[model samples]
Every structure is written in C-alpha cells, then in structure tokens.
Target: MKTFCKFLLFITLITLYQCKEEKKTTIIKKKKLDTETSSVPEKKIVKAWDSLNRHNTEAFLTEFGKQNPETKVLIKTDFGNIKLRLYKDTPIHRANFIFLTKIKYFNTTVFYRVAKNFVIQGGNSDEMYTQKERNKYGNYLLKPEFRKNRRHKYGALAAAREWKRNPNKLSSPFEFYMVQKKSGAYHLDNEHTVFGEVISGFRTLEKISKVRVGVDEWPVDDVKMTIEILD
Candidate 1:
C-alpha cells in the first residue's frame, strides 16, 4: 500500500510539471506574437510628390493632369494672396506645379529674385527648410512647353531654367517667375514654360516686383510665400 501511494504521488508530480511546462510555453508564444504585432510599422501612403524620378515622363504628367482637372492655385504671401489659373494645354508644366502645390512644397519659400519692373521669380530661399524640401523632391526638369498662345504677358507665371548649362532649356523644377511689367516680356514667350497666369491679385505681383532688391536680385526684405491647390 505504501509503495502504491508513492507511485501515485510521483505520477501526479510528473503530470503537474508537464502541465506547468505547457502553460509556460503557451505564454512565451503569446508574448512573442504580441511583440511581433507591436513591432510592425504602419504602411505609409505614397504621395505623387514622393519619389519624383526622371523616369516619370509625359505619360505620368498626363495621368496626373487627368486626375486633377481643376487649374487654379492660391499663392499666399505676407503682402497678399494671388490666384493663378494653370493652362491645360501646357499639361506637363501644369501638372508639375499642381503636384508641388498639393505637397505643400512651396511653404516658407520666398520671392528670392525680383527683377524691378520686369519679373518676380520665386520658389526658393536661403532657409534650411527650403533646401530640405528640395532634397526631398528629387532633381528633375520639365521640357519647355511653349505653346504659341502662352505668352509671357503681365502676370504670366513661368518656370526658370539654367540657361548656361541647360542647352536644352529644361526648366528648373523649383523656380518660377511672374511677369509683372505693364509691357509684357514678349521675347521670353517661346523660351520659357509659361504654365499659368494670375487671374486675380495682379496688384500683389506688381507689389512684389517693386520690392527693394540687392545686387544679386534677392529681395532686401524676405517675401515669404505659401502655395495651395484651390481646385
């Protein structure tokens, strides 16, 4: 009877130990699973402005234009707000402008280059944020979209290019100039990509053009600008 009782106790201990081991294994697995789930990063939504590579050609621009048919953008500045209507005919340039605006790429930029009585060039500044934003958007250029109808008239919004190295006259993705002179800059009609024109706030353009500038054409006082896509 004593031997049987001992045997029964040993068996119960063995069973209890096995059960405890199984429960511990289950807890470890659950912890590992919870940790793995918590560690997974959320998937980020890719924006059109993200990964703007040179490979994105006319087709991509066309698709983008198709998606966003509305052509207006509001340029907010300390001076005032200017409204611009992008030309559908210049699809590539228009699409590029729209993409930049949608991404808030022009925020905190400045009307850096102001040609007195001629043009007010913007979309750049000496600020660190400006450079950081530019670096975020890859270096890419748009082939000049010079339609016969798109002239560099007063309030004409056109892209600027590096004329020295850019023999092809591809426009700088980040810089644009607005014609502020009463007598239009007709000579630049076919030379630059005039994507949009100011529909309202011509006075603001004029005011920016008249701002005092130093030797390099940079405004003596910074005229910060923020752009938003209206439609």
Candidate 2:
C-alpha cells in the first residue's frame, strides 16, 4: 500500500511538472510574437494625388524641401542648357521644382504640350509606365501662391492647373508652362501662379518653342529634359 501511494505521488509530481513546462512555453511564444509585432511600425501610406488638397503650408514646405531645396536648376533640353534661377520669394514653388529636378523627375519625359509663340508644357511622359512611376513617389497638389509681383512675363515658368473647372482655385502641383513669347502671358497674371523664371535660358527656351508640333502642339520629335542644381 505504501509502495502504491509512493508511485501515485511520483506520477502527480511528474504531471504537475509537465503542465508547468507547457505553461512556460506558451508564455514564451506569446511574448515573442508580441515583441515582433511591436518592432515593426506601421508606415503612413499616402497617395500622390491625395496630397494636393493638403491645407497645411508647413507640410507643403516640408515635402517641397524633401524634393527640391535648391535655389537654381539647369534644364538640359534638346535645344541647350536652360539655366534657371528659382524665385527665392516663392519658397514653396521653388523648393518643389528643385526637388523634382534633383531626382531627375523630368528625365526622358517629352514636352507633351506646346503652343506656338505662347507656352511650352512638360512633365508628362509618353511612356506607358510614367504614371505608375509618379504614383510610387507622391500624389499631392500645391495650393496656389499667387502674388501680384509675380507676373506671367516672358520666360516665366508657371504652374498649370485645371483652370476651367477650378475657378479661383489656382492649384497645379506637378505641371508647368513656360512663357515663350515676348508679349508676356499678361492675361494669366492674376490667374496662375508664376513661380520661377529663365535667368539665363530665355534664348534656349525660344529655340524649343520654335520646335514644330502636332494638333495639341506636342513636339513631333520628343524634347527631353534633364536637370541639375547650381545653388
């Protein structure tokens, strides 16, 4: 009987020991899983198109700085090097262009739209994957910072907007049109944001402006643009 009692005690102790080990293993596994989850932070995902409506000027300034903090850019166009001095006054617009240029955002992109003796527009690509590439970077729009001092003069690089639909809402974040004619885009002075000007490349711009185009003024042969920062 004593032997039987001793055997039962031994079995009980072994069972308890096994249970305790299993409980410890389970706790360890849960803790490991928790630690792994905590280590990886959830990234704030934002679409490029959605970024346009942001009302925060500081946020716009921050992203602009991330993309283009420089004060000058050299557009290596087919015509020649169009050295441009970004407006120090228009900080948001200037910074944004610098960012796009530094990253070669306009490389290989065709001057999609051109108006003879008027404006030359670039930043869209004929390549099928250009839109996808743009998506990967950002989708945001710039709130128009139209100043009276910034006129739509010849050689002025101005942001393009969906003006027909966006009455009084001047916001064109990605695209820009250069004033090619000497008469100046006076009609556009109060309408669009005139951000930068051709400090040294007005002549090169004139040459590109003369390039022949189709119905939409899209240059028959692509006019590729590469950019470099000076200051």
Candidate 3:
C-alpha cells in the first residue's frame, strides 16, 4: 500500500510539472504576439504612405500628426538652416509637410520667390525634375485651409498661389512664402494657407529675404532648400 501511495504521488508531480511547462510556453507565445501586434500599426502607416506616393492627396494628409502634437521642421537652405514651427491646428498642412520631408521632396526645390520687405517664397521651381515630380505626385490647388486664429502676420509661413483667378481658393501645393516685414500682409488672410511660423530662423530668413531678385521677385541665384525634422 505504501508503494502504491508513492507511485500515485509521483504521477501527480509529473502532471503538475507538465502543466507548469505548458503555462510558460503560453506566456511566451502571448508576449511575442503582443509585440508583433503593436508593430503592425507602424508598418501599416509606412505601407499606406508608400501606396499614396503616386498622387493621393488625402492619403498623403493622413501621414502627419493627427492626434499627436505639432512638430518643428528645419529647412537646410543654401544660405543657412531656417527653422519653422508648424501649426497644430492645421493638421492637413502640417502632415503634408511632414510627408514631403520624409520623402526628401524638398531636396532639389529652390526658394524661388523672394520679395524684399514682404515675403520669401519656395517649393516650386524651373527644375524639370521638380515639375515632373509635381506633375507625378500632386497638383497645384488646395481649397485654401484658412483658419481664423491664424493669419498672414509677420514671419508667417504661408502657401503661394499662381494668380487671382481663385481669390477664395488657395493655389500651389508645394510653394510656400515667409513674411519678413512688420506691416503684415493681412490682405492675404483669405487667399493663402498659413500653416507655419519662424520659431528660430528669423535671422536666416532676413538674410535670404534680402537677396537680390529679378522683376518677378525670384532670387537672381537659386536658393536651394532641403528639409529635415530635428525632433
């Protein structure tokens, strides 16, 4: 009877050991699955952006800080690095910029428009490649996302337009202008989309804004622009 009881105890011990091992395996599998699931959203985001690389404006819009806070952008120009703070209120414009920077879209574009004592414009150029890329990825019109709190003030970074045909609608998806003077082009309140401001690069902007320009306010020498995110 003692031997029988010992055999029974041994059987119980072995069963408990097997159960413990099974539980450990289950925990390990669960941890791995959680890690993988967390990474899926990130991979999906990149995949979505890549899918929209062709010409989806709304898809491009989703790539920016929707629920996340606003971000700063550093425009490394031929003259100097001009830092700009993007608007948290304007998600579409902010995201558009973030997406553009990630794709190195501004690497070859120039600060083509420079108006002394007024504003400095950038993003579109005579670069055949730029024109072709613009033709490829996006067009030249956004229904001017004008917010009341934001206006065309000094140091305001606003979008540029082609002509006065659409006074209420904004034009130029790529081209943007930076205000340099204090008078403040308030007249442009309803016309252009002001999406950002100069947080640290006003001095650099002043230098670029004062560069020699032709009759069209285009810089005599091309001021090349490259964009990156520091934080």
List where candidate 1 sits over 4 angstroms from the true fold. 1-48
lDDT of 3 by residue, 77-167 (tens): 7677888998877777777777667777788899888878888888877878787777666473555678998898898988777675675
Greater lDDT among 1 and 3 belongs to: 1
Highest TM-score model number? 1
lDDT on C-alpha atoms for all candidate structures: 0.86, 0.77, 0.78
CA shift of 85, model 3, Å: 0.7
Candidate 2 regions off by >4 Å?
1-60, 63-68
Compare the candidates by lDDT and give the number of the best one: 1
Stretches of candidate 3 off by over 4 Å are 1-47, 53-56, 63-70
Error of 3 at 111 (Å): 0.9
Cα error, residue 4 of model 1, in Å, equals: 59
The per-prediction tally of clashing pairs is: 0, 10, 0
Best-to-worst order by lDDT is: 1, 3, 2
Candidate with better TM-score, 1 vs 3: 1
RMSD of 2: 6.1
Please give, for residues 26-136, the per-residue lDDT of candidate 1 as tens digits.
999999999887866779887764657667756667788789787999999878999999999989899888887877778868899998888999998888877887777
Clashing pairs in 3: none
